[model samples]
Each structure stands twice: as structure tokens, then as C-alpha cells.
Target: MVGAWIWNRNKERVETCSAKAVVLATGGAAKVYQYTTNPDVSSGDGIAMAWRAGCRVANLEFNQFHPTALYHPQARNFLLTEALRGEGAHLKRPDGTRFMPDFDERGELAPRDIVARAIDHEMKRLGVDCMFLDISHKPEAFVRQHFPMIYEKLLGLGIDLTKDPVPVVPAAHYTCGGVMVDDNGRTDVDGLYAIGEVSYTGLHGANRMASNSLLECLVYGWSAAEDITRRLPLAQKVATLPAWDESQVEIPDELVEIPDELVVIQHNWHELRLLMWDYVGLCAPPAGWSAPCGALPCSNRSWMSITPASASRIICWNCAIWCRWRSLSYAARCCVRRAAVCIIPSTIRSRCLTAARRYSRPWLT
Candidate 1:
């Protein structure tokens, strides 16, 4: 919490910043999953930094998967918001039969967790890639008027939102757990505050309701600001903070060598994403949880073996991803242990096992 060593992208060098208080608003880690509605920048950097700074992160196992994202190949991460369902869209199978009623009485209007589980269950049971969301029964004018941007986006993607049932699937939407923070957004580390999706304020619990994320951010952002202002007057100022030193850092002689290293890093990134999605994803069963938890330590060791003083920005990012990945694996293991102790009901456990059995492929093992 003393200061930060920042990579100055514009200057192509490292810079140092000393601050009395630091706030992390760096979104969530949805990009850790293969399929997510989050932008590429949501790579869990803030959470990783906080953890590295000795802040305790909690409940990372409760990643909320939104029930419906556009399932087209070109726009796989594009989110089709829940408003469609709120407006009376139906969740249907390939044969155009409704299925949500069988899972929950609220049907398409069920809570996000329930709806996502239902969609995931059906996709596995039918051995299909995706389900359908049909708002075609609603008038074209109504659809266009209410969802103009969605209508336009779908049109460009070659699907008529009003005339056709949009292909949909669950996608990693939000991180409900993060660095544990107090009501004033203070972390375990003094002088550092985490706000927005980066901090776990125990507001969302195991399931985050839609639109509540914004409220958490607004409330915490203001509170953190107020706390920082109150504390800033009494904060001790560092007389002389050391600047970033690259004295012993090794740089590759040949520019050509950098590409090879980058390729390896990219490959590692892909592997990590796939590992998370397959092993620790929505329906992760307790039986196979060890694989991902074990895999991360090797990756962590490998990354650490390479001296970070010589590491490139991408390598540093990959290291951060590994840090978050380890936390995620730990969270998943904790969740499994809790389930074993009967924290989760037998009915829910049975449903999760069924989904896991259906979805897991031989190659995934």
C-alpha cells in the first residue's frame, strides 16, 4: 500500500506513483472463462494485485453465469440482456418446446442462477450446443421499440430479433466474490480500498441479483471516497520512495526472440482459460475438482522459475492470471468441501452431479 510500480505504456518504461490511498475499480475476472459477457480488459487484475498485497479474497466460487448470451460464432460474448425475458420471452428447446416450467415455476422469469442452471441442464441433456430464446411472439414494433440496440445488433448478425428465436447460452457474467473489504471499502492492507467488482463487500452473497452490482459500486465508491478524505489529513507522507529500477533486468538481444516467448505465453493463457471453463465451471462436480487445483501449482511454479525482473508485460499479465487462477481453484475446492459437509442440499447436489455427468466429455479429462 506504499506505492505502485506501473508500466508506462506510452513512455515504454516503468514509473512509480506514491499515494496515501489507492482504490481498485478494475472490473471483474470474467475473461478467465472461455465464454463471458465481459470485455477483454476484465482479467481480474485488481483482485490479483490485492491478493498479492496480502488482502484476503473470498467467495470467488460464486461466479454468476448469465442465462442468455448471443450464441453466434462471431459474437459469442455479446450479452442478450435479461430484459427480453422480463418482457415475456420464452426459453425453448430446438424443437420449439418450452422447458423452464419443468425446472422452476417462474419459468423464464426465474432468478439468474436457476435460469442459467436450467439452460445448462437442457443443453447437456439434449446434447446440443445451445438453447433458444423466443421473443418472436411479441410484436415486431414492441421488440424494436423496447430493444432497439439489440434489434440492430441482431440484424447486423443476420438474425431478425422480432421474427426469429435467438440462439442463446449461459456465459460468465459477473464475479460475485472478490477481495474482502469493509463497509468503507477498506481492505486488509492499510491505505488501500477496493470498490466496484474488485471488492467483496458480502453484498451479493452467493448469488448476485441483476442491477444490484451498480448499486454496490455507487454506494461503495462514495463511501470509500469519504473514508479516504477523512483519513488523508492524518496520513503520513513518504519522504522519498524509490523509483523503478531495471538495473539487473535482462532484455533479449534479438527482437525475433520476443515473438517466440509471446507465442508461448499466449498458449499458456489459452490453456488456463480452457482449464477453468472445463474443470471449475458452473457444474463442477466434487469428484474431478482435484485436476484443476493440481494443474495451477505447476503453472505457478513454471512462471516463478522465470525471473520476473526480465519478464515482459504479457508475461506479467499471465502471472497475474495464474494468481487469480490459483485463487479460483482454491475457491472451487472450498465450495466442494462445503458441499461435502452438507452445506448444499442433497437435491441441489444431485442436480449438479447429473449436469456434470452429462456435460463432461472424455477428452476434457
Candidate 2:
């Protein structure tokens, strides 16, 4: 059941070690946000690939926002871990006044959902781009002892954690929703498996508690491995598959200078991030989902017209939007069903799921 697939960066071919049981451990889809603590590669590739392969995804709406990402133009989503807050770091306004206590009695130690929402609220209310995390009151020896990594990294970035108030903002951190998998890490697609942040295993309900993701990933990885081992003895072997089709794929007449097209792609990515950051991040209401959902098809059509090399990037962005919409609708539906009196009704979720499925059909098939 062990397998691997590596797509040639310069060519459109994917080299597979074996395809008997595909284990997709590609991590979360947090890069869809403008500001995310996720690694740059966390674009929901596993989730999108699963959906394309016809597996259902669930609970996409519950993206966990980390309350403190260092807000520096050069830092680029460097995370200031929750342990800083856990150790009595103060979340403060730009004017050096503390704010978290006003939002929650637990102050800096409140759950991520509440802290993220509070920071987001404060940022909006104060018309500020970023808030501050102050742990400067701690002894420098203690700071360096506890957070050697963050301290050194911040120091390298010219911000001393021992002296400076770290400029921070809430950023998309973890995806609580993903391709639905059973306890054995099995998806709807037979012989296909998902684990890590890519699979929704009912461990993280609405919000993911701290440090549980790594634990869940380790547990599920072992489970999937065990399940595959048991089935390996009876596994069906297949002949070598056909090569990739380039018939419908049009190679450009030349590597045409399409900086404008590339610029458009950049603009599209920027716009997508803006829509999510403004509407979907931290606090999502029904009204916020409208603009992005409405724009998806048009943006997708534009992206589809690009050259094949660029089309790959386009497809990634398109799939990100599609999955986000599905997650939002799914969560909205569950919320409405439970309460039965919310602005986002269950029907909205049903329609969103149906439409997203229909929309993705052509892309993967």
C-alpha cells in the first residue's frame, strides 16, 4: 500500500512509484488566505485532489485563526506561538494599552477562536493594520530560555522579543475541515487514503484545540498504515497505466511573453485572498460569502484561457475558492439546522454543496 507520485516540474507528467492505494497527506489549505501562519505550500492540494477524485469534504468553514502572527512586511507570516500568550504575554493596542482582558476574562489565555476573534475585532475597531504582543516585561533570561527559537528568529528580523512589542495580527492557521475520512483514514474513493491535516476525522469539531493537530496526524498516520498493511496481502495489482494526454492541452506557439497575463493571475490571487480575509477569516457570516461565490466562475473562466503552465496555478486558486465555498456552506447548514433560526439557513448549505460539486465535476473528470 506504500505509494508515491512526483509530478515533473518542467513537464506535465506524473511519475508514480505505485498507485495501489494513494495516501494523500498533503497538509491544510491555509494559503488561500492573504494572511496565514501556514507554510506557503498549504494550498489544500490534498483536499482538492480528493474532491476531484470524488470524495466528499466536510466542515471547511471552521478554519482556526492564530491570534498572533508577526506583522512585518519582510517577516512573511512568521508565527508567534500561543505559548507566548500562555506565558503571560500581553495583547495590546498600538497605544500600549492592553485589550484582551476586555474581550475575555481569561485575557491572553482564552481559546484560539475567542482570541482570534477578539484581535480581529480590535484591529477593525481601532482602524489599525496590526496589534501588538508585549512580553517585554519578562526577564530576558527567562524569555530566551523558554522561546529560544522565536527569540532568535525575531532578533534576526531586527525585532528583539526581549525588548520590543511584537506587532501581531490574527492569521489563518489551521483548517479544521477537510476530505471526509472514516476511522481507518479511508475516503469515498476506494484504495485512496488521507491523513494529517488533509483528512477530516471528526477529531476537531468546530474549533481545533491547541496541539491536537500533531497528535491527530500521528494517530491517523499509524491507523492508515496499519489498515493498508492488513489489506496489502490481498491487494489487487494493475498493469502500467497510460501516459498523460496532451491532445486537448495546447502548448503555446512559443513561450509567449505574457507578463500581463501573469499580472492578471497575481491580481486574481490577491483578490481571492482579500475576499477570504475580509469575509471568511475568523468570523464568517452568510453575507460575507456572497462576493467570492459570485466571482468564482468568471475568475475561473479567465484563468482557464491561460497557457497550460500557468493553468496549473489557476487551477490551484480555483480549487481553493471552490473548497472554501463548500466548507462555508456545510458549516452554515449545520449551524442553521442546530439553531433553526439563523440567517444562513440549511438550504443555503445544500445549494452551495450541490453547486460546488457540479462546478468541480468538469475540472477533475
Candidate 3:
């Protein structure tokens, strides 16, 4: 059994629940992006918390922007699944001109990266809020039969898919990097396991295919279950752990801060999101990433000075900084590899030595 210490959001009290082991399966961090097909809960709490606990995060450079998400303010992160493109939807300009063929020969069937970039390019060039996806030219009965749910949902939104092209935009959809885990989803911390999107098992290297990622999640879920079951009997014989001590420190009278301080965090939050969306987002170049990369440290310093009352939110800000730092470094490496002639042997040695320190530690116990 795995248990958790739940914190009451209202009363702000910490309560403990215990089990043999603990797992972090808190979904992806798509909420970091301005426009994403993720719920508000997908704010990377697991990734941030695990990193704070000394786990190495990997491959955060590979965030995928799904090619088509509904572009209605009222729809709230609603994804128009890839199956629509599969069943012969055409990406068109507002004037009814098909545009995907100009970007790639595969047209609507191109790989996600190609399609997403094309759509983004068109939107930017045309100065439009969104592009249109049309399948209306197909028989109405066929559209209704194949995509009944989409049809009905769009109808409710006052869109008749049989006549009008659905407005769409590319949105951050999946994160391909997270807590580095092994074949069994075990993290660096003993008795701590991470699975699903929270754990980076190296399955989806650069871009995750829509169908494959779901399959990866299912496979790992079964694998983790089997591994945990096999270890449970031995786990039951372990010595009793000490209970958490509530008296070690005084409880803060408050978690929320004064309005002035709160204003700082809110301002930084808005700036960070817009920076991430515009700079570090899809089509980010190393040079374009410089200003935002520099801003992260400044944001961190400001967030840090805001007092301990908002420590939890500070941790979140730190995590966001870490992700941006890692992404900038990844992009820099790409630029280096493309333009530089040689890698410095000393730098490689230092990186190897640093990696060596964590490699020999106990991962499971």
C-alpha cells in the first residue's frame, strides 16, 4: 500500500496517511504554457516536488504541441483529436484556400511537428487568431457517423461541422521529459516510484505519437503494479517508520501574503507565461530564448524575496525556472552542435564526473 500526507486546502493543515511505498504519477506540465490542452491541475507539481527531493529531470526539451486544439475561449483546453485529421480534414485559410500542401506534400497527414509549425506560421503571417480545419466538404452523414461526439459538441457550441470549418490552434499538449526513472518506474529515492507522465522512462525520445504515449502509459502501469506486488511481502517486514512531528516548528499564521507581495508573484507569473509562450514555445531558437532565459533568474530572485508565507508557490516558481533553464541549455547545445567545430574535453569530463556522483546510489530498497 502506498499512502500520502494530504494537506487540507481550506484549513491548511498537514495530515499523514501511510503505506509501504509512495508513487508520484501527477500528470504532465502542459499548464506551464499559455495555451494548452491541460487541466489546471496539470501544473507540474510532481515534477517540481520530485526535483526538490533531489531527483534528476531529463529531456524537458521535448514538449509537444498538438496540431489541433479547439480555438474557442469557451471550450477551455478542449482537444480536437488527431483522428479528425486522419479521417480527411483539410487545413484551410479563412478565404477557403487549402494551405497544408504548400508547407508539406503530406498536407494534413504530415508529422505533428511539421503540421504544428505550418499552422503556427500561417497564423502569424496572416495575423489571425486561428486557422480553420475543414471536413465539411465530405458527406454530412459520413461526418456525423465518424465523429458523432465532435459533431454534437461543436453543434452545442453553435458550430455545424457539416457547413463551417472548425477553428483550431496548436496548443502545448504533452511533456516528454520528467523525473528520470528506470524500467520499473523507480526514482532515485528509495521506496519512491514515479510513473505515467510524471516519470520520464525514455520511451518517447523527442516527439510522442498520440497512440504510442497512451500505450506507454498502460504498459508502465502494469509493469509498476507487478514490481510493487513482488516487493510488498518484503516491505511488510520492514521496521516501523517514525511519525511526522508537528511541534518541531510553529505553524505560520497564514499562507497567503499581503497584497503588495502577492502582486509581485502575480505579475511575474503573467510575464513568465507570456515569455514562455512567445520565446521558449514551438519554433524557439537559441538566440530567441536568450531574453527569457535571462529573465528567469531575475524572476526567481524577486519570488525568493517575497517571504516564506508563500513558500509552496515559490517552489512552483523555482520549478518553472528549472524547466526554462534546462530548455535554454538544451537549445544552446543544439546551436553549438550545429555551428561549433569541437567540444571542449574538460567540459565533457566535468559533466561526466557530476553524473557519476548520482549513478552509484541506491535506487530501490
Candidate 4:
């Protein structure tokens, strides 16, 4: 069950931003993609709200993508936990070559960001769809014990985990930056507090260190509660409070439609994924992504930059990425032939090609 506090009272109007102290236990930002390792609902809404509330947000450029997520037509977004890799698993290449040993000494057990980028580099360099993670070398009993869920899932896929390699790829999974907060989870504004995935507390640093997100959450929560409990006794320390003055406020009749531009929304989601994948994935400098993501200027261009020419190719790319995610399979021989046969456009080119060429940077993750 989801943990939350429900306030039953219905307000006359929706709040633009929250003012009361709040502990947003909302988790990671994984839904900002076509594929993710997190539940579909983890789209950083708390951070968005806190951002609207004029809080200082830091490290937004840091996103952690999981190294090995399952890929299938029906179940491409499911996660294969790090625990599986920790025990003993080999990340493999298309020809069944064990490749992770070359990237790092830790092999399959390296930190997620590093492993993810390693796999990404391999895919991009080889022009392949996806890579594989082999755990089938273990005994069937060991597989069932260490990863019962994975074993059963693979069984349903008509694959035996004790015999074959499991396909996997990196997917956008976590956000490291959030609204700034103090020792008590308090924002710069008084009477305001942010918690959980919505606050940046410097615990994760540039890249998360595995399973520590839960620890950080618990520690920050305890500190915030302790501070509040200590201050509750002197509640009336500020007796003279401001008045509720609604002098020039009026309800507007026009319902301003949200940015319901479907193409734009899809475009931005893809861009955010690609951007984080390129810029924030692993071993990046703290000041690296800061320049492009510095201010309104970059975000502005981002909103304009996505077009049919710019991101439409991603549908094919992401589909290809997901197709071989968990199966160590490839369709390079025939898939392209079938896909390219039915294409017809006035011109397959647009100004988007120029924009991509101009703004392309290695720093984009």
C-alpha cells in the first residue's frame, strides 16, 4: 500500500503551490520515458510542485539510469534488480561475448550508472539494438533462491534462466536533484518543508550508491520529525501573524488549457530521456550538465527543438532498444528491411536535422 496522509477537507479552489509543511514521500522519477525500471507513476510531481513554489532546486541534471532492465514487447519496462547482478551475472554482447569484464573490474556488479553507460556505449558503438545479462550459469536452485521472480518471469518467456542469458538494458530510473532543504526538511520559506524524493540533501552526491535512497529517506524523515517535535511546545513564538487579504483576487471564467500538445509532450519526454541518458548517466562532472541546463534559455530551446525530424526516429530506436532488452535477440538482418519498405514522406528531412546537428553535444545525457 502507498504511504500517505489524507486531508479530507475539500478546498474551494486548487492550490497553486503548497504552503504548509509537507513531507512528499513520492519516490523516483521513472515515468518520464517510454521505458523505465520504476513504477509508471514515479514522475517527480513533488519536485515539479516544489519548483513552482519558488524553492531552490539543485542537481536536477543528475539522473540515474538502471543498468539492466528487462525488455520485451509486453514487458519491456520491468526491472531486474541489482541484487541479481550482485550475486553473479555476466553482461553479454550480441554474439554471446561476455563484455562487462572489459569495462570495469567489477564486471556485472559495478555501480548502476557506470554499468549503464558502458552498455550504452556498446550499443551505440556497435549499432546494435540491445545487450544481454547472463545469469543462467548458476544452478537452478540458486536462481530460484536469489531471484525467484526473475526465474519465474523468464520461465513464462519460454526461456530457462538456468540455461540462457537474460536480455537487459539501462533505463531512466532515478533523479538525484530536488528542492533544497535544511536539517528539518524545511525550504528557504518559513512554514514550508519538503521531504523524500522532492528534497536534495547531498546524501547521494553525483551518483547514488545503491540501496541508500531508502536510508536517506528514513534519516531525513526522523530529523524533520524531531525538529518539529522540539518546536511544537513553543508554537506561539510568533503571535502576530499576517492577515488573509484577498483584495484584488477574482476567479477567472476561462479555463486555461494545460499544455495538452500531444506531440510536444511526447517530444519532451523523449528528449528528457535522451538528455539524461547522455548527460547524467554516470561518472559525469558535477559541473558538466550545468551549462546547457543553466537556466530558462536551454529549457526554452528544448521546448522548441523537438520536431518530427528530431525525435520521430526515436520511436524506432526505442522500440529496437526494447525488443532485445531481455532476450539477447537481434533483428538487424530483416527488421530494418520490413520497417523501411512502407515509408513514404514528402521528404524524410526537415529543419530538425539542422537543429540536431547544431546543438549536438557529448554532454547531453
Candidate whose TM-score is highest = 1
Write the residue-wise lDDT of candidate 1 on 1-365 in tens digits.
Answer: 57777655556556789888888888877777767888766777788678767889776656788889988888756889899999999999999999998877798998876788778777878889899999999999999999999999999999999999999988989888888999999999999999999889999876688789999999999999999999998988854558877665554444214445545555666776766766566776656555565564224443433333345443343434334444433344443333344224445433334455554342124
**All candidates: CA RMSD (Å):** 5.2, 8.6, 9.8, 13.8
State the weakest 10-residue window (summed lDDT) of model 2: 333-342
lDDT by residue (tens digit), candidate 4, 1-365: 11222321243211232223446665645554445777644666556545545777675545566878887666656788888788788888989998777767787887665577677767777887679888777887888887887788888987677888777777866666677888778876555567776678888754576777788788888988887677656554433334333332332223113233344445545655454444334423333233224321123433232222112232222321221221111111111121232122443221212222232232133
Residue pairs in steric clash, candidate 4? 167-325, 167-326, 168-325, 275-365, 276-365, 277-365, 278-364, 278-365, 279-364, 279-365
> Model 1 lDDT vs. the true structure?
0.73
Model 3 is weakest, by summed lDDT over 10 consecutive residues, at: 356-365
Poorest lDDT segment (10 consecutive residues) of candidate 4 = 326-335
Off by over 4 Å in 1: 95-97, 249-259, 297-300, 305-309, 313-365
- The numbered model that scores best in lDDT is 1
lDDT of 1 at 116: 83
* Model 4 ranges with Cα > 4 A deviation: 1-20, 30-35, 109-111, 157-159, 229-260, 283-365
> Which runs in model 3 stand beyond 4 Å of their true positions?
1-4, 10-12, 235-257, 260-267, 302-365
Q: TM-score of every model?
A: 0.80, 0.78, 0.75, 0.63
Q: Could you give the candidate ranking by lDDT, starting with the highest? A: 1, 2, 3, 4
lDDT of 2 by residue, 1-365 (tens): 33544556556544556567889988887777778988756777778667766898777666677788989888788789889999989999999999877766799999776677778777877799999999999999999999999998999989999999999988988878888999889999888999999889989876678889999988889999999899877887855655544355553544334445444555655666666676556554444455345543223333333333244443333333333433333333322232222234434433222332333322112
Question: What tens-digit string does per-residue lDDT give for candidate 3 at 56-109?
Answer: 877654677888989997887688878888989999988889898886779899
